[model samples]
Target: MKNKEFIFLMILAAFLSATESYALDIEFSGSRHTVIKDKPEASTGLNDVFTIYDIKEVSFISIGNIIAPSDFRVLIYSNLGGGYAIEQPVSITGTTAFIHNPKGDMGYIVEDGDNRYCFWVVDYAGKHFDISSIEAYPEQDCDMTKITVIGSGDQIRYYSVSGRQCTLSRNIELSYNTLEWDNENNSYSLVEKTAGFEYLQTPLTLRPPFYCNTTVTVSGDRFLKTWGLGKTLESSIIEANGIDVNTEAVQTNLAPDDASNMIKSDGTMLGGSAPADFTFYAYVTDAVLHNEWQIADDPEFEYVRYRFNERDLTYTFDQEGKFYVRFIGSNADGSCEATGETYEIGIGASDLRIPNVFSPDGDGVNDTWKVGYRSLVEFKCWIFDRNGHQLFYFDRPELGWDGKHHGKTVSPGVYYYVIEAKGADGKKYKKGGDINILRYRKIGNSSGASGE
Candidate 1:
């Protein structure tokens, strides 16, 4: 009744006509005893009351843009157990005011106090049903957009952050379907409405660096210039605008004087050991960007990352191998790259010891004539007789001679041996000396024969 019009659908009208005998109606109230007649019912306060004047049951209630069953959930509550208790669920027809209640039907007084009952409208499915007035359900939270309207007519406008214009009159119930423009505030606002949550706008494109101008300077400040049309001194001045500068990555170049050394686990330089750490030194140069140095284990540069100190241009290698490293740098403006040449480092070459003697009588004690070297790059060993005839030859250090040539055990003698080995430092080492092969243990000796 509150100066608002109620537009009922055709189905609602027909249904109301059939149930006119019940005189079903909703009532509203104010603090000063002012009653609104036939208005869309809204709860004014905790004490506000609503009544289903003379209805036996309710199927649903229509409020704002929601038509019940199709858009929201409705529940009826009875004042019981010192508080309001939910009584039953109500189904709705998208077009009617109230239909037949399938659950426990109640033909009783509905109010806001102990003597009456109450109802709830729920947006259980996230349909974003906008309840126009807080007075409709003062105790329940309802979806609504709060807005302030100012000005009149062409000067009126709706105001909100990034708002739009308003078009509706003052003090009217608003819904998601309503769009009003306000001219005075120069912004748009939803009087008491909601359209769910808004999504973020698309991002703007990023612009690349641009070169404003490029001036080529000459050695002399004032250059002597000759012109046909006009005589003038040409200065080093080239002016332009909107010229994009393409950035490139710096090239990696390593110095030839770079050094690498193997160290023991105790941090001492490696002399003769297997598990030794290695350190690589990158000579500081203009083209080298210490912070951008990247070291890899394999030739393909797909190796494990090692800890490096850019201030010293050094990296420690815990494993043994040839590692590849390079320097890559880029300007802050992203307009140029400086890459250094790739440098290879060899490590784990401190231990290359060849035994001076071995008793190869197969007693498992110095049974094989071999060299002990960690990460040996390449190796070849040869044993010769007094006349320089090659008695035994071996290529792999792991596969050494057993003091035998073609299954024939050689007699115990002082044999001359030559070893050619490639160290992890990429350097070839040749060692020739006399190896005394003493037959300390015979094949079946009861007491192992001992000899010098």
Candidate 2:
């Protein structure tokens, strides 16, 4: 959502002057248990199909019945329609109902003919549903006037039911409508009012982890269920590393590393190790401290970081937007407050930190640049080339490093890798997973490689 907002593709917003939206006339009775059609005089019996449209709102009530009391349920649907993905299901309450992404999903429920009373109110546009395979569904012999369309779309199709030929299409939005399921004392309609809430989504700056395939929660949404860096730092900042960081991101210095974790709805918390070498902290204020604060020059994350209290005070978030990032440097000699560069993003605070770097000079320190899930429950790692070729694949963290092929060391010049580890729980399904990879420096043969 950085530059573009998510919009529902289904549109006819002002098809014929927004003011002249169509309306639906509704009537219901408790005794008959079916919607009463005084205006449209439609008859929806055991099996009948029709198309409905131009409907704005309807009001009525139905009586008790064996199935759905002539309310919303107890109805059949052949071809259903609504807005774009907005029609996604939030949750389900029926059995044997699984949702498939591209294959499409359909649902069906039967009324055991038991006396029951139930009614429900649903949002028309923002969301919709499909119901089929019912006793009356696809049965065209019932009645036709009982069903009609309330929207316009060639998308309306039909469903052939065993021993029945009734088919109906339901597609409408932005308005309220009502109908009955049966002809008993039950009648239905929409007449009450409800409340609505709105929110403004904020843009997130963190890129998908470069480690490998795994999930990371950004802002509040979880992304990159499995990831690993594949492209060189010079290629698209949005390589296999996940998410996207600008190519201009600093390499001389890295962004401060500060990642926090929250428990998912299932009580799964991703407690993984952060790059052990980098130090990052954040604080915020209103005024930009260009003079007092000396943040890192061309910080990788592009956020201002100043030194203070002898500690690395570079990535402090300016919550209040007040002011206060002073550069401070420390050496083997001593540490003191110093002015750092002054960098800025957005109004308050923002930036990502790349605490992990590979330059594994034979210094024998920070030696292994690899993904770790010591805390994540189930782990799966993948190594890929810049062209998306899968290389080394591991299922555990302890199995990292050694940087060898079948039996020899693999040449190194920034090979691409991704990880698909599972932490928290429900792994095989990809959850609290994160990605990271190994960076090795191939010098001498297995000998000098020491414990080579």
Candidate 3:
């Protein structure tokens, strides 16, 4: 019984050891170029594909650490057809394999039973390319700019033109394998790498124009490799001659009133009492052919009230209506225009008054004890019983408390209210007073005031 248990334990240990040593590795010789090993993407049945650049031919290839060497076969795939015949290695010695002067631009796969290992060979000799010059010029008809790149290469792998606010890039599709080896058919087959997606071939001379001063970069690739990994021969920084207009309008004066606790304006939007002076300044880019500050009654600028041709304007808004202000800037030819965001400026008379009593008798006339307010920015009100227990609180003047506590009607009595408020017109308020709650009872079709 002990011998039988020992034999079973030995067999289990050997099985785990063999499973751990099943990983295979391949090596290449007679290649002075660098090797790039790319792992397969997620859910792609493809294996790691090795890439070698600037090599005309590989002298020999070796597969090491291979288990069951007879079951492994090195197959070189043709790049022309999908169902073409596969080529075999010239010789195989132990775990090493060799091919006689293997051609470039071909994919090879090592079949180890059901597993497949893929690799690519690229002959990049005398295939170098460089950019001679990059020139930028404005169009004759409009303000659109155009860039032209002069280079000598098989294909442009990637190019980008970047500016202060915009960037345009064009890249080639080379990282993915659209055709994978099929074991059953002994040929290459088309496979969808991603669902509902197909690779797009980038054009060589698809250079788009830039709006501002930009930097231009370009690279070229002659063999199959990922974009941007190729050598970039030249990069140029260009200054645009055409105008790219950008404008901003901001309020400069942000002083609060001294007599009241008025919140300071952030210059984006201003409101408050009448006779307010608001100073607006413009921050613009590029050469301005014509610029103006306009004030309108509507947001769409259908009725423009005033127009100032200066870069800055300081106007006193004494009216009692909401106004909109914006700045517009244009280029010399008016082909390019830029407009700042419209700012809403409200100028209204400040008024806030609280009622002494309110009757929430479900009559909808004086149901809530809201205050009569106009342009009141900040407000807070608190209601308490005679014993100083807080019953209701509100921050906006538009909201009022009904004569109820804890979701039930309170007893008819006098309640105290405390208020702390600040108006948009820089007026501070701190007032408290008695609030009388009256309940009316209908008797014989006649309403009579009962609790007060």
Candidate 4:
């Protein structure tokens, strides 16, 4: 182990890295290049392995801080795959012995041999666990106290461009519930005070003379101010700091546009088509989030999700049986990864859809008549007096009932219902209901009384 540690030191001295290692445990070969480990299903490479016997360095992926009793993810370049930056994230447990490489490219890991090895320790407190041995990156040397911009067409989406930071109160809480900090379901956000980044929207096209430079500024957080994009694209820019970020999402246009049109369908700006009104659909996608990249874009399990890339749908099953549901689309770069929505399914739902709520009260809330299908091409609902005499018809969900017949409130009694609808499936499903309206009211000259 001592010999292995010596080798790691030598390689780190050679790399002369510029990044700060935060939570990851790193190691290197004799050349100072990184060693890579990866887990594909996740965006942050949480499952990558860092070899200890080999020995090297640990460098923060960038400039940041790592806290003990919390889960940290690291990214390392691979010396094995010909200089490729592979992920070698280390989930620290014990007060593991690791340090930054000379170049800051990695965390010089303990070589496994005589007395050193990089491994974590675990413990079960009252209810949770604790993980420690964390390090923070160095602060940027540049002052950058000021912010400026030089262009338009400024657009920032996803977790990309925010200026909000966590504010700690005078009384700080130091209790570490390892499970709360290390659980995949647990996320900790620290909003720090930062400045010097902005997002500005210049005219879609350079108004007069066209220049290639464009800029966005993001300010207000210290942690983000130092995240240099490597190359400057435009002088006019927007910037922000102290905001939450999924740094692992380095790829471009990889997530679905939550508000854009459904992919390949009507209202879509990219793929799919805009079908004429009334189309039925049912689709399902995973709700699991591999990493923090698209954390804010995940679907609501009890609601629906709409996307802007590819909208392909087929009827799927739900607890309510097979129903028409729709998944607008998936992101061009993301594979329903940390991007989705919640849902329910039903038959003939693509047409004027009516929820299961029916008003049987003489008082109005859902009273009078119901045409629950709001977006229907053609819809009709009929109410009868049990003798089969048609008394009401409705076509819109918003159309309410006053519980009256010929300007007189109908008496509390049993009623019959029939519905006709033209749904997205083109095929019609005629359904009927035998309802009982049990609402009662005061009977007198302006009498005021009611019950259900």
Q: Write the per-residue lDDT of candidate 4 for residues 1-452, one digit (tens) a residue.
A: 25464345334323322233334343343423233332212222122333221232333222223344243333232222112222343444454423234232122222222222111111111211111211111221111112222322122211100111211111111111110112253333222221222233221111111111123222211111222211222133222111111111111221233222122223311112112222222222222212221111223424323332323222121111222222332222334322223232222234333333344443444554444331233455777777888766665333544455655566777777677765444545477876656655544323222222
Judged by lDDT against the true structure, how good is candidate 2?
0.26
lDDT, residue 184, candidate 2:
50
Which prediction has the highest lDDT against the true structure?
A: 3
Q: Which ten residues in a row are the worst by lDDT in model 1? A: 218-227
Candidate closest to the true structure, highest TM-score: 3
Q: Please, what is the TM-score per model?
A: 0.31, 0.18, 0.52, 0.23
Model 1, backbone clash pairs (residues 3+ apart or across chains), number: 45
433 Cα displacement, candidate 1 (Å):
1.0
Model 3 / residue 217 / CA error / Å: 5.4
Which parts of model 4 are misplaced by more than 4 Å? 1-378, 384-390, 397-402, 412-416, 422-427, 431-439, 443-452
Instruction: Show where candidate 2 strays beyond 4 Å.
Output: 1-356, 359-362, 425-442, 447-452
Candidate 3, residue 304: CA error in Å?
A: 2.6
Which scores better on lDDT, 2 or 4? 4
CA shift at 349, candidate 3, in angstroms?
4.4
List per-prediction Cα lDDT, in the order shown.
0.36, 0.26, 0.54, 0.30
Give per-residue CA lDDT, model 2, range 174-255, as digits (tens).
Answer: 1112221222522222232111111111111121112112222111000011112111111111111211111111212222
Model 3 regions lying over 4 Å from their true place: 1-23, 40-45, 79-85, 137-146, 153-237, 241-255, 260-268, 287-290, 349-452
Candidate 1 ranges with C-alpha deviation above 4 Å: 1-120, 123-346, 444-452
